[model samples]
Target: MKKKTTADIIENNKISDGIYSLRLKTELSNGILPGQFIGVYTENSSRILPRPISICEADEDKKELRVVYRVSGKGTGDIAAMKAGDKVHILGILGNGYDLECLKDKKNIVIMAGGIGIPPMLGLAKEIAKEFGGDNDKQISAVLGYRNSDTFLMKEFEKYCKVYVATDDGSLGYSGNVIDAMREHKLTPDIIFACGPLPMLRGVKSCAQVADIPAYISLEERMACGVGACLGCVCKTVKKDAHSNVNNARICTDGPVFLAAEVDI
Candidate 1:
């Protein structure tokens, strides 16, 4: 269920260049899932549309949710100016998250994330570890991709699973993209979950198809209304909907998470 509430900014800190981690104390954090997102209202009155950010970590005990976002435009810039103790309107635990039930039987799980896409994978790693007993018992591997070395959340991922990094400029772990790192390291997994740019997701999809591994991908799209009423964030799918009789799916409502084979992208 989604709720519209005012959440207090518990902490808003910059973790790296152009990237920030924002933590909010809200009741909505209780039921948030790994690949779900929250719609945050920014200070820009000129733009009424809320910016949708993926949930990084949800602490039900603390009643808080964390989101790591990049400062891309006016809306996000306005959000970055907010400080601790500040309150903002948030509507969430939105979107369909990853289906972990489908992955329970799969022993080897590979989580691939790129840039800002890395945050959601953190919660996923922790969930997988907790499910299987502990980090040591699970074959969970996190393959992360970044432009350079000044990356955030690497250490956090290390706490839950084996971490492999790939940087574009060779300033970090592996010298190429994450798929290259995985290929070179020969880390084959029974299933894969990925969230990143379209190109990266496409590449991961191709690799997973060739390897015959089940894969899920979280997509990011421009949304005016986070609910289904707007029809603003639709993407072409491989299969048509039974009721709507269309081959398009909404990123905000129908998903943010979809099977790589189902989506056209």
Candidate 2:
């Protein structure tokens, strides 16, 4: 159920080079889950297509949704130029988010994320803390990957999970990738939730498969409609999708979040 709504911008600030964190006051926050995304329309009439951004944080009580994105093109550039009082049209609470119920019985939970993927995990971690209570500190942990020491949302995550870092240039924590960080720290999880670039997801898939741990991943893709109307954001799946009767699943509708076992990516 996607509805087009106008939202007021609370704040739009730079998180780092090329990355911006945006928070909007919207009514569409009721059923939002960890991995869902929204289609944000640009003020420029020339750019009819909206930018599909992952929901970094969804505050149902406050009716606020936070989205962190990298300004890669003209569309996002236009969005970055928006200010506090600006209004934007967005279609949202879209995409199937992470399912946390199934992981409840698991003793240990680990969240793995990289780069912009780190934002959503913050919300997920907070929910995980709420779901598990005081035991969260011991049972949950996060393994985050970054290009360098410049990182955003580190303190926020520390409030919910034990944090570990991995940087490419050895500037922060581990001198390798996230998988390397996990390996070095010997941080094992009964279940894993992850989001990042395709390569990082592949590495997580390999690790999950080898260790026989249940894992879920949030995927990123380019979309035209930002809804299911176009077949633009389809991903390869292991099983046939009942609706389309094919091996492809729409990332916008079917998921941005999916079980690592079900999806090929």
Which candidate leads the pack in lDDT?
A: 1
Tens-digit per-residue lDDT, 31-111, candidate 2: 888888899999899999988888888888999999998888999999999999999999876888888787657878889
Task: Write the residue-wise lDDT of candidate 1 on 123-241 in tens digits.
Answer: 88888777774644358899999999999999999988889999999998999899999888899888999999889999988998998888999998788899877778988998785
Model 1, residue 10: distance off in Å is 0.7
RMSD of 2: 1.3
Q: Stretches of candidate 1 above 4 Å error?
A: 133-137
Q: What lDDT score goes with residue 80 in model 1?
A: 96
Candidates in order have lDDT scores of 0.89, 0.88
Model 1, residue 137: C-alpha shift (Å): 6.3
For model 2, which pairs clash?
A: none
